[model samples]
Target: MRKIILSASVSLDGCFEGADGGLDWHLVDDELHTHFNDQLRGMSAFLMGRVNYELMARVWPDADADPSSSGPEAEFAGIWRETPKIVFSRTLDRAGPDATVMREVDPEAILELKRRPGGDMSIGGARLAARFRQHDLIDEYRVYVHPVILGRGRPLFEPSDDRKPLALAGTHTFGNGVVLLHYKSD
Candidate 1:
């Protein structure tokens, strides 16, 4: 079965975004972006929340067309456009080409998706990830920890009463002080 990997970048303090919803703290240099592209190129699909999908649609679709985009940015634009996407949202009326909007999370449906013949899926969006985590749907977590402490921002994980154990699969340290911590659900 293909795995559902929850991939995200967080600050040293575990915040994914700043207080004002700014991502300027994200240290996605060419090296890091290239690494992201390398990982995403093998994914079968992107499982994301409506907000995340809409945010991506607004930028990635035209990123490559912009002459100012870097090589990694241009490459990611292609990857984002070509890969199939599954958006979870009830309010979203429609999605663009190669995208599907589901009204809610169906554990059996997600399991069927995992059983399909293809590469593993990369899941994003904190709320959606939280739901997947609650359902025990995620197989792995790829948390990229950057070397900065955000005084305040939206945290990556919410308060949970349950204990979830994750085994360390591996780790990769980037040149830009970002570390990718790979953990598998136990």
Candidate 2:
């Protein structure tokens, strides 16, 4: 079975976004970008929330068309734009070709997708990840823990009744003081 991997760049204080949903705090350095790009190589499908989809839709597909673009962001955006995405939202009427609105129900759709033939399905966005966590549907957690501490923001994990134990699979420190942590559900 394919794995439901939840991955994100989060602050030391466990905030995924700053007040006003500012994500300027999470910067992808060369080493970190390379590391994340390598991880993306194995992902066959991408899943995210509507908010994240809207945010990502602005830059990813258009990055290649921009003449002023340069460096890893362009490359990452190209790859991200090409990847198949499933965005979960009740209010979203339609999504572009790069992504489609999820038609099935939440956890069931995730499970069905996991069982299908694929490399690995990646779950992005904090809200979507929280939903997976709430349903105990996530198989792995690939987290990039940045050194900065934001005292307030949207949390990585929302209030839920379900809580499962995780075993650390690996840890690596990058040059930019970011720690890459891989954990598997126990």
Best by lDDT: 1
RMSD of 2: 1.6
lDDT of 2 by residue, 1-186 (tens): 999888888999988899779999986787787777778867888888898888888887878577776666677787787789888898888888877897534677778888899788888888678767877888999888999999899888877777688999999999889998999998
**Model 2 alpha-carbon drift over 4 Å, by segment:** 103-105
- lDDT (10s digit) by residue, model 1, range 30-126: 9999999999999999998999999999999879999999999999999998999999999988899889999899999999999999999999988
Number of residue pairs clashing in candidate 1, backbone atoms closer than 3 angstroms, sequence gap of 3 or more or interchain = 0
**lDDT assessment of candidate 2:** 0.83
On the 0 to 100 scale, the lDDT of residue 180 in model 2 is 84
lDDT of 1: 0.94
Clashing pairs in 2: none
In Å, residue 180's CA in model 2 sits off its true spot by 1.0
In model 1, the Cα lDDT at residue 112 comes to 97
